[model samples]
Target chain A: MLKVNDINVYYGNIHAIKGVSFEVNEGEIVTLIGANGAGKSTILKTISGLLRSTTGSIEFLGHNISNTPPHKIVSQSLAHVPEGRRIFLQMTVQENLEMGAFTQDGSKLRQDLDDVYKQFPRLNERQRQIAGTLSGGEQQMLAIGRALMSHPKLLMLDEPSMGLAPILVEQIFDIIKALRDNGTTILLVEQNAQMALSIADRAYVLETGKIILSGTGQDLIQSDEIRKAYLGG
Target chain B: MVFLSYLISGISLGSVYAMIALGYTMVYGIAKMLNFAHGDVIMVGGYVSLIAMTSWGLPVWAAVVVAMVACTVLGVVIEGLAYRPLRSAPSLAVLITAIGVSYFLQNSAQLIFSPNPKSYPVIINGSLSLFGGKLTISYISLVTFLVCVIIMIALTLFTSRSKMGKAMRAVSEDKGAAQLMGINVNRTISMTFAIGSALAAVAGVFLCSSYTTLMPTTGSMPGIKAFTAAVFGGIGSIPGAFLGGLLLGIIEAMAKAYISTNISNAIVFAVLIVVLLVRPAGLLGKYVPEKV
Candidate 1:
């Protein structure tokens, strides 16, 4: 479970996330759907300790990780698959997986590798191939598989479907659903509200750094305002 | 026979440059910043080794170890104190800070050692005479060549296989993503400088030994050339550093022998400019297309 309360983040003088608050219960695919510049990525970054919240706090599985460093926050079983699938392009798929286990010794690394490979067999096939050469779908798979390498309690995914073909996007969404079914709590941020809401257990609609609406997946999908605004009628 | 001798000498000088250039390239690959102070760390290593041998009355082996440990500490300290704060600053700010560190080390050495040129001790003495003494190879040159080769092989393995090595490569490509994957970016960078500085100690020893003169500014010229070698061979490639160093060394030797010794340095740099114009990425470096 993760709890974010009234967190405000800034980039120099520009206010980014302004007093935004949200939560994700255990075993829920909690989706944050918003347009560009809605501070979705910034909120995820702040939770992962890549950027600091100027006020308020973030709690993850009982730890007040508000001020923890990014690297340390990772060891706490919270893996963030950053926006744009930032896999180490020069590295092999296997090497990228190994990097996900960076905060750990090799005790469970072999097993974790097996788990990731099982999840994304395309990644296993291209284990030794350079990651940058992977197809958009495979790269997205690599990114998710890499996050799973840490055996994370909470997996935060940002724009997992960005720059992918429609079919690949469906495949990625299916993978996300499968991951949640396997009992990994996912906090997914997406501009693809229709697909996200279809799979999400609960959802929040964000606009201009504020949460404008919250409901169960089906409620938001069928909501008139949501269909008009996010779902494009 | 004359050509062979110059070639042998050239290889020896090239080996030394390769060692120094390794430090330069390794730091660049990981930290994505040029630590101009890297060469000065080598100067400090030379001083430490010289003092350990001449003043502390230590054996050659002990002195070498002392110098390496001292330089390692110095490297880590420099990264922590000088470069760490500028992590988020612009690259130009980091470059200026690196130059500042270089000057700081040089002036500190000048004040401590009085800026006088001192004779470097002969660590590897004697020579091998071959082809009926037509080709004479110094023991130090052989050692330098072997050491350079070993370092190259070891570094290749390190970057490719080891966890820390993997972390370095990851950080080099993308720092933010590396952090997301739980790699300690700061610690990885510090380790890079530490390894680089330790190698600088060895390079300093070999450089001062052949050049035969140790001074506060001794590392500056060789440092520049080795930096040139890194760029010549491709700044981030390990093999590139070795090849660049060797080529630069050979060119310097050939120029000094056949061309004007006074203009040998100029010739080496001129070659670099021409090479850059032809291949901006250096001999082994990849041309990274500009991302708009």
Candidate 2:
């Protein structure tokens, strides 16, 4: 389980995230849905310790990870696949996954790597190929696959579907659902509200850095305001 | 026969430059910043080794070990104190800070050891007679080439096979993504500095010993030349730096022998300029277009 307690984040004089809070229990897909610049990624970054939150704390499982460095956060079973898929462009696909298991003591990654390869055989096929040359969809799969290499208890994915094709987007969503079904907690941040809400156990709508609505997946999908504002109904 | 001697000597000199360029290229590769003070670390290593031998009465091997330890500590300290704070600052600011660190090290060396040139004792002696002594190879030159080759091979292995080495390569390619992978980026950068400084120590010893004159500024010209070699090879490419340094050394040695010693440096720079004009990215460098 993870908890974000009323955190506020700032960039210089500008307040980016204001009094935002949320929680995710074990074995659930909790998504934060919003348009561009709605502070969804900022909140995920804050929780992962990539960005500083001036006024609140983030607790992962039981430890207070508000002050933990991003690298330390991953060791505590929290993996963040950042925006743009940020895979090491010049490295081989296999090496990218190996880097994912860096904190897990490099030798113990055989089983973890096998599990990831089983999930995404495309990555396995291109194991020796450089990651940058991969297609947008393949890169997204590699990004998720790299995160999964860490054997995380809770995975935080920022914009997993961005720049992906519709068919590939569906595949990614299926993978997210499968991950959750396998008992891996996921906090997904997405602009694709329809796809995210379809798989999410619970969803939160953020606007201008504050949460505006919260409900179960089906409830939000059927909500007229949600359909109009996010689903484009 | 004269050309052969010059070529051999050029390779000998190039081994030192290649060694120094390893430090430059690796730090540039991983940290994404040019630590100009890297050259001064070589000077510090020279001084440490000099003191260990002349004042402390240590053997040449012990002196090398001592200098390596000293330079490694100094490299980590320099990264911690000078470069780490500028991690997020503009590259221009870091560049200026590096120049400042270079001047600081030079001046500190002058103050501590005096600016006068010191005579460096011969660490490697004797020469092999070949072609009835018409062609000769000094022990130092042979040792320099051998040591440089071993270091290069070792470093290549380190960055390729080891876990920390893999972390270093990942950090070099993408720092933020590397962090997300649970690698301590700062520690990796620090390790980069440490390894670079250790190589610098070896280079410093070989350089001073080969020239037989040690000064506060001994490392500067070679440092500049080694930096040039790094760029010539492609700034962040390891093999590029090695090949560049060797090429640069050969060219400088040839120019000095066939032409005039006074204009050898000018010729070296001229070649560098021409190479850059043709390749844009150093000999081995790849051009990455900036994303708008």
What DockQ, on C-alphas, does every prediction get?
0.92, 0.89
Q: Which whole-number lDDT from 0 to 100 does residue A29 have in model 1?
A: 98
TM-score of chain A of each: 0.98, 0.98
Please give, for residues A1-233, the per-residue lDDT of candidate 1 as tens digits: 79999999889998988889889999999999989999899989999999999899899888899999898888999999999898988899999999988887799888889888887889889989999899989999999998888888899999998999999999999998888888899999999999999999999999988889999999999999999988898
Clash counts per candidate, in order, are 0, 0
Question: In model 2, which runs have C-alpha deviations exceeding 4 angstroms?
Answer: none
The Cα local distance difference test for each model comes to 0.93, 0.93
lDDT of 1 at A118: 83
Residue-wise lDDT of candidate 1 within B192-250, one digit each (tens)?
99999999999999999998889999988888999999999999999999999999999
